[model samples]
Target: MSRFGDPEWGRRRGGRLTPPEGLGVLTALIGKQLRARLGSPAAPPARPDLDLALPDSRLVQDALDHCAAECAPDIVAHSIRCYAWGVLLADLRDIRFDREALATAALLHDIELGRTERRDRFACLCFACAGAEGARIFLEARAASPDRVTRVCDAIARHLNPDVPLKPYAESHLLNAAAALDVVGAGARALDPADRARVLATWPRGDFRRTMQAAMRREQAAAPNTRAGLLMQLGFGGLIARAPFGDTL
Candidate 1:
């Protein structure tokens, strides 16, 4: 029935996969709307408040796909995937979250790469800036209420900087978890067991990569008959879906 495309059209004829009771449905609706606005050429380069009036999941998915298609390092792609998963996990865990804020921030958390001129720092800056840009978009979209938007924007901006310790923000844990997913899900060239072990050794308390891997392992254990766990299945699937026609792996 959607004009853009039917995300769940194949699920079952005329059967809408019902949104979980309350806030879960609300978050999904808002996410869908934001996704649509992101794809609109006329949409300003700012994040929009969850208008609540216009919640459309297909739109949000499109915007995310557009962002993911802008082409960068595999690490960046992995981060976006993790960011998406983190938002989903936070929701599934019933964490009190600003889903729109988190989704926008996660999608653009590494957008700065588009502005970076340095080859070495390009990826790092891109990753951070994209998130910052997502936050910026969210903040700018709701210029009417600068206070709240700025707070979320600030969190997205500093999430990855080891120099910028996540001390005061309430969303630090979510952001850290997102960062870890990005690192762990990065291409084989970027991370392997050895590299992951070293980082996990350094940060023993709460390592995102370690956590994602552990979570992934548990999921796989639960569904041993499946080809791959859901997170990997989705992350790798996203990567493949975004790859160019002639691209390999």
Candidate 2:
């Protein structure tokens, strides 16, 4: 058994789950355990390379659980990985940010994708914008501080527009970069190899590449005149083809 209590935490083989494979899996399992423990008051010593202090508030956990419940398994996994990558990048870049705000933004960024009724709004506006609006409503209902709600909503709104500047907020910039890295492996080369390996091992992309492609296609079909549709028309094929991970799609 792995340190995280399940040796088969992220293993897939022969179209069925399997036992953990290598030392990388063990390392990632341990890393996940450490992060979970950090959510407690008497957490273990922090790693010098990165601050693993994630949001432990009841609201934060509720948001995470809500996202997981509403989204597909692959998308939930993607959101969690985005949070991990965003914080790691923030640490590496020496960027100062609100840890809870960043965590909230990362975990709920693509939430609109999980809502079927939002298709009409998404047809007119970008999914990111729709998702941002949804996030804002949810946060406000939860009584999150006005400043935190704004920051998280803003980060979610701009996460898709990599070309636009994410300035004045490290959380937004890191979230954008992190999503890009996860989606198409953009900017992934800049991350430490070991760290990248551990993140992937812990989350295990599964069928994310194909799932993401299908989601984008659906978005395009619904909103062919929107930014997502325009991007899909322009070079989405090339982007998917260039993704570093296995293209099972």
The candidate that wins on TM-score is 2
The CA lDDT at 248 in model 1 is 19
Segments of candidate 2 deviating more than 4 angstroms: 1-53, 114-117, 121-124, 164-166, 247-249
**Model 2 deviation from the true structure expressed as Cα RMSD, one decimal place:** 15.9
lDDT of 2 by residue, 1-249 (tens): 311111122111111112332333344435644754555333233334664444788877988898888788888878888888888767666778888898898888887753435656432245676776678778998999998887887787767553324466677788878887788876665566667766777777888888888888876776655445555766664676677866331
How badly does each model clash, as a count of residue pairs?
23, 0
TM-score versus the correct structure, for each prediction: 0.38, 0.74
Local error of candidate 2 at residue 139 (angstroms): 0.5
> What tens digits encode model 1's per-residue C-alpha lDDT throughout 1-249?
321101122112121123232234345435644754555232122212212111244434543564566534443444444444444334434456555555555555544332323323311222243344454554565452564464455555545332223334435446645554445332222223443333323323223333334433543444322212323433533443342212212
lDDT, residue 82, model 1 = 44
State candidate 2's TM-score. 0.74
Best by lDDT: 2
